[model samples]
Target chain A: MIATTTENDSAEHPAVPTAEADRPAQSEARRRRLPFSPWHLLLAPIAVLFAFPFVQMIMVSFMPSRDINRLPPRFIPTTVTLDGYRGLLERSDVLIWLTNTVIVSTVAVGSNVVLCSLAGYGFARLRFRGRNVSFLAILGTIMIPIQLLMIPTYVMFARLHLLNSLAALIVPWLATAFGVFLMRQFFLSVPRELEEAGLLDGASRLRILWHIVLPLARPSLMTLAVFTLVGSWNDLIWPVIAISDSNLFTLQIGLANFQGVRRTEWSLLMAGNVVAVLPLLVGFLVAQKHFLATMSSTGLKG
Target chain B: MARSATVAVPEDASTATGAGRRTQRRSEQLAGMAFVAPAVIVIVGLGIFPAAWATLLALQKWNGFSEPRFVGADNFERMSRDTDLVAAAWHTLLYTGLFMPVSVVGGLLLAAALNRRIRFMGLYRTAIFVPYVASAAVTGLLANFVFNPEVGVVNNVFRVLGLPQQGWLEDPSQAMVVLVIMSLWGQLGFVTVIYLAALQDVDTACLEAAEVDGASASQRFRHITVPQVAPATAFVVIWQTIQCIQLFDLVYTTTRGGPIGATTTLVYYLWEQAFRQLSFGYGSAIAWVLFVVTMVMTLVLVAIQRRRGGEQPA
Candidate 1:
């Protein structure tokens, strides 16, 4: 790579000073000539179109209940207040819901990371009979619509006498096939020399994995952790089916119930929406770099 | 001659070492199996068994309180005869068909637009992706307000334009439309980001080469960009179709499959039968059909992907 770089450098920019020889002259020149290309200008309308709903949601969250409900909707709040927050905090079960959401998401994400990584590593690195078959079968699960699993899962939970429990909310999601696939892809990219070095030192595969592989795989693991955390935190349907007790209801489910129970309580509902969605937004914002990288890498083909 | 003689002696010793290495490899395989056991156990015990049992339950008669009676194919036959189940299946297909094209195509456009290095690109990306990360329940709750028909922001916008106000969720025709639109809104971000990533990795040299060869921008994009991103498109289409077919939360919250079961997709219908009506056997039958439909759709998608792969340049 270094040898080719020198060749390309000499070929492309002979007249440039040696100190500036390595820069991508073409791209840099294009940047200097016209930084704001017409292509870049197309982003404005598209961004606004995509962003309108969120801006509306944020603005509406602060408005007085009556103003929010008006036919000619108030684009901006005439009187901004924390009344919605206060109402939601004091009057609703938002706190309990928030706690439940935290517990379910934490348990689910924690279990998913450990289990999926182990499975992923085994699938990626280990030699075993039926390895391909097992992996394929797991991948097959991804094709099956999750809705098909819902009724059966609910019935099974009911039979297990685990209905309306937090366990119902957390247990089934502990081993996701997608997470395994991601980890397997990541593990495949890791060099075998590191593992061989550990093995030569009389470290068992498990010990080597724990000490060397896990630490090396921190970024991928963090990506998986964030995926699990965000997914579990935002999941809405399973909790609705599984947990009937209001106290056990996660934030999402509780907010739905809150809306149904008090349709006109815009202040409470908006406040609840803000509270429920805040953690997820905060979580994503903090991990935005990892999140974006993971999104692009996993989803796109090129 | 000296080197050859020395190599001949070490060959035997090296063969012994190779044999020992093979033995070590076997033991490592056993240890690897040990490491993978927890995941396999969980998948088999919790995931596979439940799915298999559910398939069997479709053939039985159980209404939660009653002992599950072996009712062999009665549920299936009943499902075939039921108009509601038929309507529900059709609705599901309709929903999936509508959702897939709109979301995937819209996502493609948005992703292509966003992939450009524009001002505040990070903020734009986040703004678009926000809905995807928000809980369906929260979005559904907000949708209720936004599309309330009487005092909804949608109607309010219409009113501002001096147009007729309509109750989006209450009207059957409008209800389904609202559900589809809301689904498109939430799903676009996911598909767009995926496509954006794919777009970034497109070989700029290839594109520039095409441009230099006097290829129009449209021709280059169509012939080069689209084909290169085919795999991403396929991935998005298949997954999006699966997700679309499983549209439950919005339907459940916004319409409850109502204004007269006009929005009754398969899952909602299954939920209604199993949970609300306590008709477990029949509901399981519907659930099985849904599973089969999804499996078939997935297989078809796989077949398409395989065909595409076969045609790709080596």
Candidate 2:
């Protein structure tokens, strides 16, 4: 049923945008007809409820310890203070953790973009022995749960003496199967004629990829980079298992340890959370449309 | 040079002959393999190779410091008699049972509500989706503060509303419930965004035509909109189930498998067994069972989607 629906939908209505696109004229017409839709009454309250945790997290991070521990848990702090942030900075290796995370994420994004695109283009355009088999093998690996891989992976890392260092984090995120699959899908949708034209002009395959294909693939590359950055930055379980050194800990591992040791220090924990989450939040807000578009499009196809 | 070879072979095939074509084909093949080599090495080295090693590890007795000794099916036999594993399995089932439907259905309802042209639609969408981007560790930390028994905001609200206060994460009976709530808070936005994308692609021409034929709004929606988004619904369901089965991060950050091990999902249980207790073989056995269960569940879901209406699982 799924197969049929996908085939028929694509064949029948090709013009329908897969990603969210603004239709200002239709929205303007609807706005003139009904100044307020009844849906807003329901959505507005639900939005507030959904957004409450984030608001609370930020507010609680600024509140003094006593205010946070108050009986009637004040929504608005009577007085804002820098004590929580100051304590987090003094008590934890949060700055070092932040730097480590940035390094890991930056390396991950760069590697995934380069490696996945090369493999994706190879699978999409070239005629080679075992291309389909190899691609399918890589895709099948995506379904293998990380739980299954960890025990033996840990053993392997132990044998190689790659444990308790950043390489343990960096190696696994170098090139993901999901990244390759996503890039291949994007490449397949691109017009073959574009590459053929380059071929006609005597461009090498690598030259064509760099000059013709990569420019057109900017959106998919950004999507891949965003996903890799977020995944590596937020990764906790693996880092917790692999790196026990406090100085080498990423932001997530540090925050988890911080929470365990200082359970009663609500302000400190909240401040750590805000610090860990702010960079991503800022990135998402700045590229809201691209972020939303990439997520929705990839979700539907994958 | 490969570039010169291409340049020498002009558009007219009559000028080049079979040798030129063969040379070009060989070069292309070489280029393809060169492009794919790095990815293959990483994926096989890290992903596939480790998986094969895990299968072997499941049959061995290892404690990290000693050499692994092959023990055949002893590890698998141990699983049959393990009570903690049974509890963890049941907890995983309970989590999947509750989380999969509620999030998917809630997403559909919310997507429908937000589908129409409205002011501040982008703002509403952003507010909902913000939680999905937050790390599970952070969400778990925030959940502890918000749901704390004594000084939590939820309890304070309960007191104001004249309701009895109750222990949340500290109470074994209520800890799983709290975990589920936190998970939904973080995941519902993802499901909603996918559904919203599907809803936008529903054929508006068909809906307008139905309206001209005097069909009621609810009738058109039930018959038309529901069928159109079936594939996305299937995708969301399967994806959410996989996520629920792999529940670890939130449990680690919030309960640490909890007050009485009440919230110990399978992954957390395996992690503790291997990492904490140094029973690598038994942990690998649990991991294998989990992998098989996930594969079966995915197959079953895909089969159901096929039978429903030939809707392809995205």
**Regions of model 1 farther than 4 Å from truth:** A1-42, A126-137, A297-302, B1-30, B201-203, B312-314
Best by DockQ: 2
Q: Candidate 2 chain A, which ten residues in sequence have the lowest lDDT sum? A: A12-21
Candidate 1 lDDT, B1-314, residue by residue in tens? 12112211111111226776786667656655655565665565566666777787889988877798999999999988999988987887888777888887788777766554335656667777767667788778777877877657788778879999897888877778888888877777778877765665566677777877778767877888788888788889877877766778887777789888889988888888987888877877887887787778877997998899889884
Model 2: how far is A225 from its true place, Å?
Answer: 1.0
> What C-alpha lDDT values do all the predictions have?
0.73, 0.82
lDDT, candidate 2, at A109: 91
lDDT of 2: 0.82
lDDT of 2 by residue, A1-302 (tens): 23343344433222122322223246446565556666678989989988998899899889987787776778888899888899999999999999999999998999889889988998998888889888878987888989999988898898899888889989899888888888888889989898887776667778888898889998888878888888999998889888988889999988988898999988888999999999988888776655665566557334
Question: Which structure among the candidates has the greatest TM-score?
Answer: 2
